[model samples]
Target: MVDKPVPDATRRSEKSRRAIHDAALALVAEVGYPKTTVEAIAARAGVGKQTIYRWWPSKADVLLEAFLDLGAQTARELGQEPYVIPDTGDLAVDLKAVLRATVDELLDPRFEAPARALAAEGLVNEPLGREFVAKLLEPQLRLYVDRLRSAQDAGDVRPDVDPRIALELFVSPLAQRWLQHTGPISYEYTDTLVDYALHGLAPR
Candidate 1:
């Protein structure tokens, strides 16, 4: 069967939805999570609050979808596959490539301010924090988990290693630097992280 053409009204709605997502991201970056409301996002987007409500159940819902959209856009711009980590048959190379991309994302101005705001709120608000981690963070982390598991099958990683916990050796460090400003982030830094995580630091 031939695909039905998209209606003009639906196209208009999609455009409005993109506006809402962009407005929500910008507002959250400026105002923090506690103060960024549905009304505020609608106003910033020049859409009616009812328009936002018609599409999303709550402010958090809008924000979540906004972030998901942001990641997809970034992925496309970078020419990388969205929502998947590359294997390349080398675990260390794969890890470093992903980490470098992450460093780029963390440094991106559009993503940085809003992500920092949400992360700060997530720290103080347990439920919100957990929800964000579950939805936004965990899925990304799972890509690493899958990569590590594949490494194990290929004998690149020790069979005894737990993919979930093992992957954290590099990920958490980058997250700490990004979230806490503990240190500067760079391709070299993340590359070092991947090396140390995969190979013991104590002269291994």
Candidate 2:
């Protein structure tokens, strides 16, 4: 059987949701997360506060969804279908490609400011931090997990190596630099990370 068309009201609601997401990202980028309130998002989005509340309980919730949408948009912009990691049997190549894309995302001006602000907030606010990690970070990390597991199955990665731990060798360093300004973020830097993570820091 064929599916029916979406209702006009549903289409309008979706359009409003997109507007809200765009507004949330813009507000957070402009004003920081703490000052970005529901009323402000409503006004910027051209919707009522009740419209936002009908879909999300709070500003944090709206921002979270907005950030998730941003990730997908960024992925598409980078020529990646969101939430997927390539599993070419060559683990090094696959890892480098993903890391390079991540470096691009981290370096993007549109993403950097708001992400940094939210990250700083997450650092001091334990509950919010946990929510952010659980809602956004972990799911993204799991894509690496699945990719590494594929590599292990292909004998491209050591059987004894744990995918989750192995992934952090590349991911955490990039994350630290991006989140804390510990160092510069670049394609070459992430490429080196993929090498070091896969080939061991010592000899060989």
Candidate 3:
């Protein structure tokens, strides 16, 4: 009898990794991060625990990477280029467009549950929180910083303004509202935020 062709190792490994990521994300979303475990993820993934151990040191790391993958995957599904802040040369228009997209992402049910779980855990878990910020959140924020710097170069933003701090004006309020459920989130709400942030409260 002819020997069967061997499966491609790289393709097999990638499929397993995607399975592991999905399992980890779903488990955390269902049970919360504190209760999610490597064994649980591995079992859910249909892979051995040793398979997980081979790639990640801990559950936190797995979840972090899983979340990152989820973002990229979700962006692809939405037809967006992940991690990009578009520069249309009109600062207000650019910022508003991005914030509107953010509103849509924050409200997406598939992303919301797992993202909230991880974000909640990051608040009290200092090391995980720091790592989360450093690895995931900060990089996205830096895109805003870069865009603000470019706006400054065009004299759209004041040269003396700090791009980092200026971004917080629009970004932080929406984050607070989302995380705390303080108010509704919508394109309109976010558009208003961009307006107020860019133009200020006093009569324009």
Candidate 4:
């Protein structure tokens, strides 16, 4: 008898994982976080509920990993490294570049809808909110903090300035605008934010 070809288990697993991530994101975007359950995600992904349970403990874990996968995929598509802040010698230019990328990501419909749903849910569900912050937001914020610290070392920022607080000057405003629909987010707007943040409003 002829030897049979071996099945590519890894490739099959990857396909299923991607499907699960996509399904979780879509479900959360369409139904909001509270209504997006593990069973729903598994059904939407065309995977057995047992498969989802085997991979993740809860719906929140599934959603978190899905967002993470989405971010990494987006970064690859953009030809940028995932979860990194650039460190060019010019602090203002570097900040503007990163923030401009952020603006693009925020405006992307694929990212926007699910992100808004999660943020809204986080507001009411304290435990989920904390998990979101701990798993996602805080790590991203640390990137900014690290970049700011480098700028400080180079004397681009004041030694007295707190990197943690300093980063919020630009990051918080952009987040607020995107989350609250208070204003349009554009590359130009983010560039202005970087400039104003690097150079005080009181003038040189």
Best by TM-score: 1
Better of 2 and 4 by TM-score: 4
Estimate the overall C-alpha local distance difference test score of candidate 4: 0.91
Model 4: residue 148 alpha-carbon error in angstroms: 0.8
Q: In each prediction, how many residue pairs overlap at the backbone (N, C-alpha, C within less than 3 A)?
A: 0, 0, 0, 0
Q: CA lDDT of 156 in candidate 2?
A: 84
User: Deviation in angstroms for 152 in model 3?
Assistant: 0.2
Shift of residue 196 alpha carbon in model 4, Å: 1.3
Model 1 RMSD in angstroms: 1.9
Clashing pairs in 2: none
Which of 1 and 2 is ahead in lDDT? 1
TM-score per model over all chains: 0.96, 0.92, 0.93, 0.94
Candidate 3 lDDT over 1-204, as tens digits, reads 997876799779999999999999899899998899999999999999999999999998898899889888878887878567888889889998888888988998878898889889989999988999999889889999999999889988889998889999989988989898999998888889888888889995
TM-score of 2: 0.92
Better candidate number, 1 or 3, judged by TM-score: 1
Q: What is the lDDT of candidate 3?
A: 0.89
Q: How would the candidate models be sorted by TM-score, starting from the highest? A: 1, 4, 3, 2
- What is candidate 1's local distance difference test score? 0.92
- Model 4 collision count: 0
